[model samples]
Target: MATEHPAKARAPHRRPFQVATGVLGDLMFTTGVLLALLVAYSLWWTDVTVARHTGVAAEHLRQRWSAAAPAAPPTGTADTAVPPRFEADDGIGFLHVPAMGVGYQVLIKIGTGEDTLAEGVAGAYTNPYSSAMPWEPQGNFALAAHRDGHGAKFHDLDVLKPGDPLVVETRDRWYVYRVDATLPKTSKHDTGVIAPVPTGSPYTVPGRYITLTTCTPVYTSLYRMAVWGSLVREQPVDPDRTPPPELRKEDPSNG
Candidate 1:
């Protein structure tokens, strides 16, 4: 009879509270896991898409450079006519480099007025605020590009040495330049390293001068690496004349 008291039936209904708490905890943990997965997937997809688009843009530029050929001669006799300024749509007609396998379409945008530089493509390293443009006769024709490891637009710039040939083909003519010197960027000097032609210097020069600038140490932007080349030769585009074996077809075959 004493045992019949049965310890007051021990509150049999309390089981529901424990079950509810376990269910809520599990739901919360699952939601957190799903949210984390979504975040990771979003970031990875973004990076992959950007890289793919960059490669496509780079290849398109290279192909345009390859397909361009010099302008044909006049139907009749020799007529002297100054060509128009370079433009992006005109295509890159010529490219030259003997030391390393390098070539690309030379695009010229208006340095004055609006932002003419191509989007997604590397820009000329020179200051955009300056009065001079890349193709201007006396202005700084500076160029900018991503290092080889990332975008690698001008990866071979470091390989250029003195005497290396640099030829740029426009619709009507081939502008040739010779590598003269390489300068390491410095903070103290006003050498106008990125200027198309050295300004404020005693040397008075004519024609076009090209300055190739890129991230220093091959793949880093810690310092600017520049290669200066002067106009060495100028050849008129003659459709009747065949280009040199090296120049006729794209060298390196791969841009």
Candidate 2:
């Protein structure tokens, strides 16, 4: 009776305690999520917007060309190559690279600025650098576009093998070029590849050339990847005649 039953003991309540680095860990995780979202926006959202802009640009070009075209005069048996007109705000021409893929085409624009290239079009080099126009008899018409994002116009450029047809369609002519060589890696500042003779190319003499350039390794810009081509023939625009056989062919890289 004097000593009652031993008093029952209760376990102590335990609660999680914040570590010294808990806040830092949370901050790091949040930053990672933001970066991922940015990438997704660049890769997906930009593509959707560029596609719409490209459609608009192509339509505007069609309308302008249609208005400028007069009743087809009898084109005599001669080189009826019409000079391509470049518009600062419109498409200059359309590129068709069959070896890259079937139904592959991209509009060529005037400037290589971020806004212009983001529209899913090839940008002609100008200012501090220049490129030969498609109508040029002997020069390099070098162009650049995105390889990984912002429409990725030249994503499949690396797939093009030598001799693949690279067609440039202007208002009144189709300048056909044949892929001569490709440079898988080169300095981004190397401007010689866009030269009239395109140094380091298979040919050293001046000739009608076209150089397609984009970032290399698919997703990084540490280096540039270039595809050089020589003008094979200039096909006069004809409503009756279909595209050249080279352009009509399926993806040669596949077969």
Candidate 3:
């Protein structure tokens, strides 16, 4: 019988292949994790930078207004008369509510320009085409602000309840408004809440009316949440004492 030649043992190259595959898999997973972390860091930095710039711009504007104010006449005197048109300032003059912590420098811009609300904060001007000015005696004085996690300017607006005080301070005067009702998102037919002073009426009231609008559902733009307040009082900014504005009757009676 011929002796069978011993089969040469094959070298264990399969072990090397398996080891290479494991290393590749681990590298791919590490790359994916690093990419995800970079993206998250970028978004966080962007938001914080924007907020800082907004605060700086607001402060600069306030300083300018303060300097100009002292040059003007004293409140309640014939020399110091409130203008029919409102002026938008850079810094917040007076805070409205201590509870809600809603404070910002009021701005009055005409015709809803592109840059009106571009600064990641509440626009100082009204959307001239959409609604009337909130401080105006006639028409719906509508105001808009961001409600998401971005700027969070009007985030606390929903917390407001009926009878909450809303304050507006200028260089010379302070306007006081009281929350009357809250309106949910609705169709045009649901004009009961937006109707002038009286419910279900087309006519506008002579007294000042304010409508604070922001995105509803907290952090989503699915709907609009509006808080309505009517002018309750007007107080002149006195050197020694400050008082709230008195409620006055709506003047125009019709839009």
Top candidate on lDDT is 2
- Point out where model 2 deviates above 4 Å: 1-18, 71-90, 251-255
Candidates sorted on TM-score, descending: 2, 3, 1
Off by over 4 Å in 1: 1-79, 85-95, 102-140, 187-191, 199-207, 240-255
In model 2, what is the error at residue 218, expressed in angstroms?
Answer: 2.6
Give candidate 3 regions above 4 Å deviation. Answer: 1-47, 69-95, 102-115, 128-139, 187-206, 240-255
Per-candidate RMSD vs. true structure? 10.1, 4.9, 9.9
Model 2 Cα shift for residue 254 (angstroms): 18
Q: Which 10-residue span in candidate 3 carries the lowest summed lDDT?
A: 246-255
In model 1, the clashing pairs are 123-144, 124-143, 124-144, 125-143, 125-144, 140-196
lDDT tens string, model 2, 112-196? 8888888889998884467778876678888999987788889888898897889998776788899989998899999888888
TM-scores, in order shown?
0.52, 0.84, 0.60
Query: Can you write out model 1's per-residue Cα lDDT over 40-96, one digit (the tens) per residue?
Result: 675456445545655565567556645765344544432245444544322223244
- lDDT at position 96, candidate 2: 90
* Count of backbone collisions in candidate 3: 15
Which scores greater on TM-score, model 1 or model 3?
3
